[model samples]
Target: MVHKFAFENPHLKAEAVSAVVMTDLAQQYKVMSTPHLVLNGTRAVKGRLSEETLLAAILVEAG
Candidate 1:
């Protein structure tokens, strides 16, 4: 879902990290499951979200 969104929005930068390998990084973001989104290194949303909802979060965080 996230990868698709990132692909469609070329301007948006997105990365996927392995929680198993990057344990510290995962802990920093408090990731508990797949598709965890940490926006702007602060705001975060866990679990799957609709594209519209994700976009709203990105816009709010960008502001």
Candidate 2:
């Protein structure tokens, strides 16, 4: 759903950063907690989030 959302909105670029591969970057972002979502290099949401909640956040952020 996020991929399609991003695809439709070119301004939105969603990506995944591996904690294993991008350990340094993850630390820089302070990903000490689980279920983190970063938008435009800024911390957006953290902890368990539902699909609807996540989509709503993305939409709000995009606007």
Candidate 3:
């Protein structure tokens, strides 16, 4: 599912959307997160995943 949002704070919105996209993409690839980015359905990535980091994760998982 694709998700999009707009906000007065474009910076914050961009950041949030980036993180959501990463998590969603990760879910699509079945990265094996207990709660989808969470280590054990508890802790999750505290902030947005950088493009490089997201790409590497996707590539590693895809391979």
RMSD of each: 1.7, 1.9, 11.6
User: Which candidate do you rate higher for TM-score, 1 or 2?
Assistant: 1
| CA lDDT, every model vs. true structure | 0.84, 0.76, 0.39
12: Cα error in model 2, Å: 0.9
Write model 3 residue lDDT over 1-63, tens digit each, in one string.
001222432422222223355777556545553323332233443335665664454345435
Could you give candidate 1's per-residue lDDT for residues 1-63 as a string of tens digits? 667767988877888889999999999988888878898799988877888998888888878
What is residue 45's positional error in candidate 1, in angstroms? 0.8
lDDT of 2 by residue, 1-63 (tens): 566778888877878778668889878888876667886677468878777988888767767
* Cα-based TM-score, every candidate: 0.79, 0.72, 0.29
> Considering summed lDDT, which 10 consecutive residues are worst modelled in model 1?
1-10
TM-score of 1: 0.79
Q: How close is candidate 2 to the true structure, as a TM-score?
A: 0.72
lDDT of 3: 0.39
Candidate 3 minimal-lDDT segment of 10 residues: 1-10
Model 3 ranges off by over 4 Å = 1-47
> Residue 43 in candidate 1 has what lDDT?
92
Candidate 2's C-alpha runs over 4 A off are: none
Best by lDDT: 1
